[model samples]
Target: MMDLMEESRPDTPLALRGGTRSGDHEKITVNLGFVDLGHVDLLVSEGVYANRSDFIRTAIRNQIERHADITRQSVARNPIEVGLRRYGRAELESARAAGTRLDIRVLGLAVIADDVPADLASAAIASIEVLGSLQASPAVKRVLADRLL
Candidate 1:
Protein backbone atom coordinates (compact mmCIF):
# COMPACT_ATOMS: atom_id res chain seq x y z
CA MET A 1 0.00 0.00 0.00
CA MET A 2 1.15 3.52 -0.66
CA ASP A 3 1.93 5.35 2.53
CA LEU A 4 -0.70 8.02 3.16
CA MET A 5 1.26 9.02 6.21
CA GLU A 6 2.11 12.68 6.64
CA GLU A 7 5.79 13.64 6.41
CA SER A 8 7.83 16.47 7.88
CA ARG A 9 11.05 18.18 6.85
CA PRO A 10 12.74 20.11 9.61
CA ASP A 11 14.62 22.47 7.32
CA THR A 12 11.65 23.35 5.13
CA PRO A 13 9.50 26.37 5.93
CA LEU A 14 5.91 25.64 6.91
CA ALA A 15 4.39 27.52 3.99
CA LEU A 16 6.49 25.62 1.47
CA ARG A 17 5.96 22.25 3.10
CA GLY A 18 3.48 20.57 0.78
CA GLY A 19 2.05 17.10 1.54
CA THR A 20 3.30 17.58 5.07
CA ARG A 21 0.43 19.68 6.38
CA SER A 22 -3.26 18.89 6.43
CA GLY A 23 -4.31 22.55 6.59
CA ASP A 24 -2.49 23.48 3.38
CA HIS A 25 -4.67 23.94 0.31
CA GLU A 26 -3.77 24.60 -3.29
CA LYS A 27 -6.02 27.12 -4.99
CA ILE A 28 -7.52 25.99 -8.27
CA THR A 29 -9.85 27.73 -10.69
CA VAL A 30 -12.70 25.75 -12.22
CA ASN A 31 -15.24 26.91 -14.77
CA LEU A 32 -18.66 25.44 -14.12
CA GLY A 33 -21.81 25.69 -16.22
CA PHE A 34 -24.61 27.92 -14.95
CA VAL A 35 -26.80 24.90 -14.22
CA ASP A 36 -24.09 23.28 -12.13
CA LEU A 37 -23.42 26.51 -10.26
CA GLY A 38 -27.12 26.94 -9.55
CA HIS A 39 -27.35 23.39 -8.21
CA VAL A 40 -24.38 24.01 -5.94
CA ASP A 41 -25.90 27.27 -4.72
CA LEU A 42 -29.23 25.57 -4.08
CA LEU A 43 -27.55 22.89 -2.02
CA VAL A 44 -25.73 25.51 0.01
CA SER A 45 -28.94 27.45 0.56
CA GLU A 46 -30.62 24.32 1.88
CA GLY A 47 -27.62 23.74 4.21
CA VAL A 48 -26.83 20.47 2.47
CA TYR A 49 -23.36 21.96 2.12
CA ALA A 50 -21.79 24.90 3.88
CA ASN A 51 -20.90 26.78 0.69
CA ARG A 52 -20.05 26.40 -2.98
CA SER A 53 -16.44 25.59 -2.22
CA ASP A 54 -17.45 23.05 0.38
CA PHE A 55 -19.77 21.31 -2.03
CA ILE A 56 -17.14 21.22 -4.72
CA ARG A 57 -14.53 19.94 -2.31
CA THR A 58 -16.85 17.19 -1.10
CA ALA A 59 -17.66 16.15 -4.64
CA ILE A 60 -14.01 16.04 -5.60
CA ARG A 61 -13.14 14.03 -2.51
CA ASN A 62 -15.90 11.55 -3.32
CA GLN A 63 -14.65 11.11 -6.87
CA ILE A 64 -11.11 10.63 -5.71
CA GLU A 65 -12.16 8.11 -3.11
CA ARG A 66 -14.21 6.25 -5.70
CA HIS A 67 -11.14 5.99 -7.95
CA ALA A 68 -8.72 5.17 -5.16
CA ASP A 69 -7.98 1.73 -6.61
CA ILE A 70 -7.03 3.16 -9.98
CA THR A 71 -4.81 5.76 -8.34
CA ARG A 72 -3.07 3.13 -6.23
CA GLN A 73 -2.52 0.85 -9.21
CA SER A 74 -1.06 3.74 -11.23
CA VAL A 75 1.21 4.82 -8.43
CA ALA A 76 2.42 1.27 -8.01
CA ARG A 77 3.04 0.87 -11.71
CA ASN A 78 5.06 4.08 -12.08
CA PRO A 79 8.58 4.60 -10.87
CA ILE A 80 7.88 7.95 -9.26
CA GLU A 81 8.31 9.54 -5.89
CA VAL A 82 4.90 9.80 -4.26
CA GLY A 83 5.08 12.68 -1.81
CA LEU A 84 7.36 15.63 -1.02
CA ARG A 85 10.81 15.47 -2.61
CA ARG A 86 13.23 18.21 -1.66
CA TYR A 87 16.63 18.61 -3.28
CA GLY A 88 19.06 20.87 -1.51
CA ARG A 89 22.38 22.38 -2.66
CA ALA A 90 24.40 19.85 -0.73
CA GLU A 91 22.58 16.93 -2.33
CA LEU A 92 22.88 18.43 -5.80
CA GLU A 93 26.54 19.15 -5.21
CA SER A 94 27.10 15.54 -4.34
CA ALA A 95 25.34 14.43 -7.51
CA ARG A 96 27.43 16.86 -9.53
CA ALA A 97 30.59 15.54 -7.91
CA ALA A 98 29.60 12.03 -8.90
CA GLY A 99 28.73 13.22 -12.42
CA THR A 100 25.21 11.95 -11.98
CA ARG A 101 22.17 13.90 -13.07
CA LEU A 102 18.80 13.43 -11.42
CA ASP A 103 15.61 12.72 -13.30
CA ILE A 104 12.99 13.98 -10.84
CA ARG A 105 9.58 12.36 -11.01
CA VAL A 106 7.23 13.35 -8.23
CA LEU A 107 3.49 12.83 -7.77
CA GLY A 108 2.91 15.37 -5.02
CA LEU A 109 5.44 18.15 -4.42
CA ALA A 110 9.02 18.60 -5.65
CA VAL A 111 11.17 21.32 -4.21
CA ILE A 112 14.56 22.52 -5.35
CA ALA A 113 15.90 24.53 -2.46
CA ASP A 114 16.14 28.31 -2.76
CA ASP A 115 19.85 28.26 -2.17
CA VAL A 116 20.54 26.07 -5.21
CA PRO A 117 22.16 28.11 -7.96
CA ALA A 118 20.81 27.93 -11.48
CA ASP A 119 23.97 26.47 -12.97
CA LEU A 120 24.32 23.95 -10.19
CA ALA A 121 20.75 22.81 -10.56
CA SER A 122 21.10 22.49 -14.29
CA ALA A 123 24.28 20.48 -13.87
CA ALA A 124 22.75 18.02 -11.44
CA ILE A 125 19.21 17.67 -12.72
CA ALA A 126 18.52 15.88 -16.01
CA SER A 127 14.76 16.48 -16.15
CA ILE A 128 11.75 17.23 -13.97
CA GLU A 129 8.26 15.80 -14.32
CA VAL A 130 6.10 16.80 -11.39
CA LEU A 131 2.43 15.80 -11.23
CA GLY A 132 1.58 18.36 -8.56
CA SER A 133 3.85 21.35 -7.81
CA LEU A 134 7.53 22.32 -7.95
CA GLN A 135 9.06 24.97 -5.74
CA ALA A 136 12.38 26.54 -6.74
CA SER A 137 14.12 29.84 -7.22
CA PRO A 138 13.17 31.83 -10.33
CA ALA A 139 16.70 31.62 -11.63
CA VAL A 140 16.81 27.84 -11.31
CA LYS A 141 13.40 27.53 -12.97
CA ARG A 142 14.49 29.73 -15.85
CA VAL A 143 17.70 27.81 -16.34
CA LEU A 144 15.92 24.48 -16.27
CA ALA A 145 12.93 25.49 -18.36
CA ASP A 146 13.86 23.27 -21.27
CA ARG A 147 14.22 20.29 -18.96
CA LEU A 148 10.83 20.63 -17.29
CA LEU A 149 7.83 18.57 -18.37
Candidate 2:
Protein backbone atom coordinates (compact mmCIF):
# COMPACT_ATOMS: atom_id res chain seq x y z
CA MET A 1 0.00 0.00 0.00
CA MET A 2 0.98 3.68 -0.27
CA ASP A 3 0.91 4.06 3.53
CA LEU A 4 -1.58 6.89 3.74
CA MET A 5 -1.50 6.78 7.53
CA GLU A 6 1.66 8.91 7.48
CA GLU A 7 0.69 11.07 4.51
CA SER A 8 -2.74 11.81 5.98
CA ARG A 9 -1.22 13.62 8.93
CA PRO A 10 -3.03 16.73 10.18
CA ASP A 11 -1.17 19.28 8.06
CA THR A 12 -0.78 17.22 4.89
CA PRO A 13 -3.15 17.03 1.94
CA LEU A 14 -3.73 13.39 1.06
CA ALA A 15 -4.12 14.11 -2.66
CA LEU A 16 -0.77 15.91 -2.79
CA ARG A 17 1.22 13.11 -1.14
CA GLY A 18 1.25 10.81 -4.20
CA GLY A 19 2.35 11.49 -7.77
CA THR A 20 0.04 11.33 -10.78
CA ARG A 21 2.16 8.66 -12.46
CA SER A 22 1.88 5.92 -9.86
CA GLY A 23 1.87 3.38 -12.73
CA ASP A 24 -1.34 1.86 -11.31
CA HIS A 25 -4.12 2.23 -13.78
CA GLU A 26 -7.35 0.25 -13.55
CA LYS A 27 -9.11 -1.14 -16.60
CA ILE A 28 -12.81 -0.25 -16.55
CA THR A 29 -15.69 -1.12 -18.84
CA VAL A 30 -18.22 1.52 -19.78
CA ASN A 31 -21.54 0.89 -21.46
CA LEU A 32 -22.11 3.65 -23.99
CA GLY A 33 -25.07 4.04 -26.32
CA PHE A 34 -24.57 3.27 -29.98
CA VAL A 35 -24.88 6.96 -30.90
CA ASP A 36 -22.21 7.92 -28.37
CA LEU A 37 -19.91 5.21 -29.65
CA GLY A 38 -20.46 6.42 -33.21
CA HIS A 39 -19.67 9.98 -32.18
CA VAL A 40 -16.46 8.83 -30.53
CA ASP A 41 -15.53 6.90 -33.65
CA LEU A 42 -16.29 9.96 -35.75
CA LEU A 43 -14.01 12.05 -33.59
CA VAL A 44 -11.22 9.52 -34.06
CA SER A 45 -11.80 9.33 -37.83
CA GLU A 46 -11.72 13.12 -38.11
CA GLY A 47 -8.30 13.28 -36.41
CA VAL A 48 -9.75 14.86 -33.28
CA TYR A 49 -8.44 11.88 -31.30
CA ALA A 50 -6.01 9.10 -32.03
CA ASN A 51 -8.53 6.46 -31.01
CA ARG A 52 -11.64 5.77 -28.91
CA SER A 53 -9.54 5.38 -25.80
CA ASP A 54 -7.97 8.77 -26.38
CA PHE A 55 -11.35 10.41 -26.79
CA ILE A 56 -12.77 8.80 -23.64
CA ARG A 57 -9.66 9.72 -21.68
CA THR A 58 -9.97 13.32 -22.78
CA ALA A 59 -13.64 13.41 -21.86
CA ILE A 60 -13.01 11.95 -18.41
CA ARG A 61 -10.16 14.39 -17.87
CA ASN A 62 -12.40 17.30 -18.75
CA GLN A 63 -15.07 16.15 -16.30
CA ILE A 64 -12.53 15.71 -13.56
CA GLU A 65 -11.11 19.15 -14.27
CA ARG A 66 -14.57 20.67 -14.04
CA HIS A 67 -15.01 19.17 -10.58
CA ALA A 68 -11.44 19.64 -9.38
CA ASP A 69 -12.38 21.74 -6.37
CA ILE A 70 -14.90 19.22 -5.10
CA THR A 71 -12.43 16.40 -5.62
CA ARG A 72 -9.72 18.22 -3.70
CA GLN A 73 -12.12 18.95 -0.88
CA SER A 74 -13.20 15.32 -0.68
CA VAL A 75 -9.62 14.10 -0.76
CA ALA A 76 -8.71 16.53 1.98
CA ARG A 77 -11.64 15.43 4.09
CA ASN A 78 -10.76 11.75 3.74
CA PRO A 79 -7.50 9.95 4.24
CA ILE A 80 -7.20 8.90 0.63
CA GLU A 81 -4.38 7.27 -1.30
CA VAL A 82 -4.90 8.85 -4.73
CA GLY A 83 -3.25 6.25 -6.91
CA LEU A 84 -2.78 2.50 -7.16
CA ARG A 85 -1.94 0.55 -4.02
CA ARG A 86 -1.10 -3.13 -3.82
CA TYR A 87 -0.61 -5.31 -0.79
CA GLY A 88 1.17 -8.64 -0.96
CA ARG A 89 1.67 -11.49 1.48
CA ALA A 90 5.10 -10.23 2.52
CA GLU A 91 3.78 -6.78 3.32
CA LEU A 92 0.86 -8.13 5.32
CA GLU A 93 3.15 -10.52 7.14
CA SER A 94 5.41 -7.63 8.02
CA ALA A 95 2.47 -5.63 9.29
CA ARG A 96 1.33 -8.59 11.34
CA ALA A 97 4.80 -9.06 12.79
CA ALA A 98 4.95 -5.41 13.70
CA GLY A 99 1.45 -5.50 15.22
CA THR A 100 0.24 -2.93 12.76
CA ARG A 101 -3.27 -2.96 11.44
CA LEU A 102 -4.04 -1.29 8.10
CA ASP A 103 -6.96 1.04 7.53
CA ILE A 104 -6.78 1.22 3.75
CA ARG A 105 -8.42 4.23 2.12
CA VAL A 106 -7.80 4.55 -1.56
CA LEU A 107 -9.26 6.73 -4.32
CA GLY A 108 -7.86 4.59 -7.10
CA LEU A 109 -7.12 0.88 -7.31
CA ALA A 110 -6.46 -1.30 -4.27
CA VAL A 111 -5.31 -4.83 -4.87
CA ILE A 112 -4.73 -7.59 -2.38
CA ALA A 113 -2.51 -10.16 -4.00
CA ASP A 114 -3.96 -13.53 -4.91
CA ASP A 115 -1.27 -15.28 -2.94
CA VAL A 116 -2.39 -13.73 0.32
CA PRO A 117 -4.43 -16.03 2.52
CA ALA A 118 -7.84 -14.94 3.76
CA ASP A 119 -6.98 -15.37 7.42
CA LEU A 120 -3.84 -13.26 7.08
CA ALA A 121 -5.73 -10.55 5.27
CA SER A 122 -8.38 -10.52 7.97
CA ALA A 123 -5.74 -10.17 10.63
CA ALA A 124 -3.67 -7.53 8.88
CA ILE A 125 -6.35 -5.26 7.44
CA ALA A 126 -8.55 -3.32 9.86
CA SER A 127 -10.78 -1.80 7.18
CA ILE A 128 -11.01 -0.95 3.47
CA GLU A 129 -12.40 2.23 1.93
CA VAL A 130 -11.89 2.22 -1.82
CA LEU A 131 -13.46 4.84 -4.07
CA GLY A 132 -12.51 3.16 -7.33
CA SER A 133 -11.88 -0.58 -7.50
CA LEU A 134 -10.48 -3.50 -5.53
CA GLN A 135 -9.01 -6.74 -6.86
CA ALA A 136 -8.57 -9.77 -4.64
CA SER A 137 -9.28 -13.44 -4.47
CA PRO A 138 -12.85 -14.46 -3.70
CA ALA A 139 -11.93 -15.88 -0.33
CA VAL A 140 -10.18 -12.70 0.77
CA LYS A 141 -13.06 -10.65 -0.59
CA ARG A 142 -15.51 -12.67 1.45
CA VAL A 143 -13.42 -12.36 4.58
CA LEU A 144 -13.17 -8.61 4.18
CA ALA A 145 -16.63 -7.97 2.79
CA ASP A 146 -17.99 -6.64 6.08
CA ARG A 147 -14.93 -4.41 6.46
CA LEU A 148 -15.18 -2.96 2.93
CA LEU A 149 -16.67 0.48 2.47
What would the TM-scores of all predictions be? Answer: 0.78, 0.71
Most lDDT-accurate candidate:
2
> For all candidates, what are the clash counts?
0, 0
User: How many steric clashes does model 1 contain?
Assistant: 0
Best by TM-score: 1
Candidate 1 C-alpha error for residue 54, in Å: 1.6
**Candidate 2 structure, TM-score to reference:** 0.71
Give the per-residue lDDT digits (tens) of candidate 1, residues 63-124: 98999999899888977898889999999999999999999999888889999999999999
Candidate 2 lDDT by residue in tens digits, 4-59 = 21233334322223332234544444555556667877988999998766776788
Which residue runs does candidate 2 get wrong by more than 4 Å? 1-25, 98-100
